[model samples]
Target: MLGIALLAHWLLGPPVVDFSHHSALSPIDMVATAHAEVKKPLTVNWQTLRELDYTTGKATPTVLNLLGTDTAVRVPGFMVPLDDSADAVTEFLLIPYAIACVHVPPPPPNQMIHVKMAGEKRQKVAWDPVWVQGRLQIVEMASPYGEAAYILTAVLVEPYTD
Candidate 1:
């Protein structure tokens, strides 16, 4: 019984788990690491974006507008491939979830970002964590679903590393 107790202590004691060490990262360190993961290049306010009915063949702008020319804003999001092929990235379904493309229908193209990588096509990293920086562009575009809607023009895309 004593030997079992000593073994348990050896495995689960302070020597194995040291939370009180001063060198341990503080809350501020974690916050800084998170901050480094995402950067806001440009933003369009919610009032400026014009929502259009994606279901209809005839494109009509909705009264519920959220983005415009002057209202700059930044939104954090993740990218999911529309197609099954990992390399054939014709379009990306942007969403708040790390794995939104698997089950979720995906955010509207306006809310979704169309990232155009600088220099070369952005390498595909883990899909879960990435920071997209770009300007919200209000323009008529046809989605892969054959619906026309406004889309955010993504200028840059980079993987978020901790």
Candidate 2:
């Protein structure tokens, strides 16, 4: 049954499964694990954060004057539909606001979450909150939407409260 389900998920996509009953790990627990993984500090120059304007399609790169050694932070974000298919998740971008994509494009690349699932539950499209564990690599990369943007490479996407 598990194999069949996984095969179906791969072929048909993720949304076919229901996760309302799924259990997720807490943010604190995930952080503890991430702390153990962290060997050195990663910093992002606030002034270097690039601001993109979709309306005009203009990009402005400036230096940020802020006080902090840790240039990256992992925060909880809701998953929004990136593709038309119910099962397909084209990309996972972190939003600062409850209605982030609608109001804003996205945070700097340092804030992006590139999640890597751990186990079986991780493979499934979890409606439950999952921790986006990764480092904040504020660099430019080609985006499906066009123009490389700031993003984080999520190491482990854990479960969390919605």
Candidate 3:
């Protein structure tokens, strides 16, 4: 039954998540974990972190926060491209807000996610918001802009909706 369910999930994305049960880890856990009053995130927004610039050594590059450590997470976010392509993007940056890199100063690294589409999830995707389901790691992964705090090997990438 577990195998069948996993297969089905890979082939077809599930419509909704049942957050009532806490016995299993769901995407909701990521949000709840972020809002926990007691525990604080590893990297605060104000902290100045030094990282290797994609092209050359820059004096300062804002370090993204790696929260949740190694945990299962599902989140809705906008896709930003590390490698620009017309269609069938295998890897990209998934940020918290739409048009994140558009403004003069980019959003803080803590708000960004590094995602790699795997398996059936590697289909053609638009630059629209997407709900990415997978494990989120709080590890620094290098990119052109800076480092992405969260790295997700997406099992499911579906169009996001309210």
Could you tell which candidate, 2 or 3, scores higher by TM-score? 3
lDDT of 2 by residue, 1-162 (tens): 443443345436664654323425355654454454343223333233334443343445332211123433444655543345456343555433345445445554443333322332223344544555445543455444333344554445556544
Tens-digit per-residue lDDT, 103-124, candidate 3 = 7566655566788876645546
Q: What's the true lDDT of residue 10 in model 2?
A: 41
Off by over 4 Å in 1: 1-40, 43-74, 82-91, 104-106, 118-120, 145-150
Clashing pairs in model 3, backbone N/Cα/C closer than 3 A: none
Candidate 2 TM-score, true structure as reference: 0.37
Error of 3 at 7 (Å): 23
Residue pairs in collision within model 1: 43-72, 43-73, 44-73, 46-66, 47-66, 48-66, 48-67, 48-68, 49-66, 49-67
Candidate 2 lDDT score at position 23 = 27
Off-target runs (Cα >4 Å) in candidate 2 are 1-73, 81-85, 88-90, 103-129, 141-149
lDDT values, one for every candidate: 0.46, 0.42, 0.58
Per-model TM values vs. the true structure: 0.42, 0.37, 0.53
lDDT of candidate 3 at residue 111, scale 0 to 100: 65
Per-residue accuracy of model 1 over 1-162 as CA lDDT, tens digit each? 333333344335534543335345576763454344323233433233324444542333432323444323344567666556686354564555565445446455444454444344544634566655544444555446322244544445556554
- lDDT score at residue 23, model 1, on the 0-100 scale: 43
